[model samples]
Target: MIWKEILIRYGELSTKGRNKKDFINRLRANIRHLFSDIAPLEIVSERDRMHIKIENDEQYEVLMKKLPTVFGIQSFSPVAVCSKELDDMKKLSLIIMEQFKEQEITFKVEVRRSDKTFPLESHEIQREIGGHVLRNNPNISVQVKKPDVELRIEVRQDAIYMMAQIIQGAGGMPVGSNGKSLLMLSGGIDSPVAGYLLMKRGVRLEAIHFFSPPYTSDNSLEKVKVLANELTKFGANIRLHVIPFTEIQVLIKDRVPSNTIMTTTRRMMMRIADKLREEIGALGIVTGESLGQVASQTLESLTAINDVSNTPILRPLIAFDKLEIIDIAEQIGTYETSIQPFEDCCTIFTPANPKTKPKVEKVTYYESFTEFDELIERAVRNREVYKFPEVNQVKDKFEGLL
Candidate 1:
């Protein structure tokens, strides 16, 4: 056969004290779920690593797309399987090298013979394979330290495997290992990045987005939906809860002074998110609030927001600078979409001078203007839930809660 199998290297899963099997099993299921539509495969969870064997060669393209996004996978390689003989390995090494382009290649061969009695030691196998690769590909040279390609050869009881290139993965614990959280998703850059970082830490996420219609068009809501969909590529099944925020915004603006409007609005959003978090059994709530990024994100403003939600608030970008957060946003494919000029609830009706040092008591005073208990209940009742991959289309009931 031409393409033999895929080898998966585990990250933190390898260091677990007593729960390593649990992590491996979770990772196996994750990989299988990601690959289910793409291929029929068998997963072999070994002592320290995992192997994925595909049913047909046609699934290679699908694997290339899906494998890199599976969390907990440190790296993966498409390896060629050979017989447990040095000559068989040498022959396959050349074939692996043929896949390398005409550009100058500096190479090294690393051999791990797990079967102690197979005759040739690791170094001996490396030497024989390295020499043959040098002779056959005249333009290619060897670099003992950090070569262009580190060709790997592994000898085990069943077969000999060789591969040249390694693909890096998402590299966190598998999703679903950590308890669920509610991501306070926005059309802006930071929240999407926050969701990504949490997912990387194995926290399964259901996202909540605040949409103010007319003040915020359907276009604005759709932008956040697209952002959540992009996150699915990283292996998260996100549900974007689009909450009608127009009436809440108008209520705060009409009853409160401009300076406290932003803080009060944030507190309302937090209250609604907290209620939803409990309903969904989420352990905490996540937000995009960076320290002092906006008036409503100031230390005092944050305190005002936190006062409303008993659930733990997870601000993944709390300490990050804007550029640092943007860099991650760009890397995770959410940067361009976040920078789009569609206003979500947070941006519209922003007061010129929101309270930077808002007190819990002052925020509470203005919150009394509108008896918001009924409004919050209504917002939650009318919330539209868009579970990604399946709910690709945001329904026509976009004008609800108006």
Candidate 2:
């Protein structure tokens, strides 16, 4: 009488050759984790497709809204199951076509018979269901080339499944399928977008933020937390490491030359991130550096900063233009929060004239005057970690009072 199941079709996982099963298993786990709160449901994953059965109407409505955001799914549809009888098929087909009774539309009926022992063939079943619906609804017409609406019916050993709508899914490999990385997340529009791009490619993320107190307010730290929480919707939980950078920033401003201070600051951040990456077992470091967007993102400047670490540096927005990055930021819902008037550590002691192209030898020579290894180690040791989709402890504290 109503839809009782959801059918999921695979996207890139089908072409993985021998690794298809592992990818499917990972996707199944991710879906289970995403829907852990919704109970009384069954998820059955097959070689070509997956099916989730739900008995409650409210839960079915929730699935419809959440299934589209899940990666690794090419498309999905709500399915109505019925007994294998000619009269039942006809009645269900008529009920499905009743929605378009008021408007003129072109429609087609497609059927797949997994059970070949059925009395009618695929074509015969299509004609039977198609004819029944055509006779009942005068506003509907048949167009085999490309119909406005397509009703797909599948026959199996257990029952018959019917679906009339197919919704598009977020197509990519599931998050955490590739590997884990450390993202240098700042309170900026581009870094959050960069983390999102890596997550789409199946990379699990742990974010690192540099907080300089007095120079950076508590609201700045909260802004970074908000960005990390926004990213959790696209993948698994993110562990955010907030490094104390006030000492390092003050030291750089005092010892390093004004023209090349930006380069030294960036290199220090990379060194800290690389150390944290090794401690946490992350394979690479991710940043939102767009080429030529600012002085520090140029080829020469990037090379000077990258010399501090041997880890693979991933810059997803390297070739992207500023407008392009902003467009993606808006699409993923992080644009508004990133535009808040809060200063990060990177902006506090910024020089009016920074080196757009500085040699690695010269920057390294300037940084050698100050002993940074001790401070770098100290910053990493005193870092604070926060987990995203943070649990609300305030509600628990007031439970007894209420």
lDDT of 2 by residue, 1-402 (tens): 388899999978888888898889888888887777687568899998899988887778888888887888999999988899999988888877777788899999998889888889999998999988888888999999899889899998998889888899888889899899999999999999999999888899999999999999888888898899888877478999999999999999999999999999999999999999999999999999999999999999999999999999999999999999999999888998888878899898999999999999999999999999999999999999999767663322213321
Error of 2 at 79 (Å): 1.0
TM-score, cand. 1 vs. native = 0.94
Tens digit per residue, CA lDDT, model 1, 208-264: 988888898777787788888888877657888989888989988899888888888
TM-scores of the models, in the order given: 0.94, 0.94
lDDT of each: 0.85, 0.90
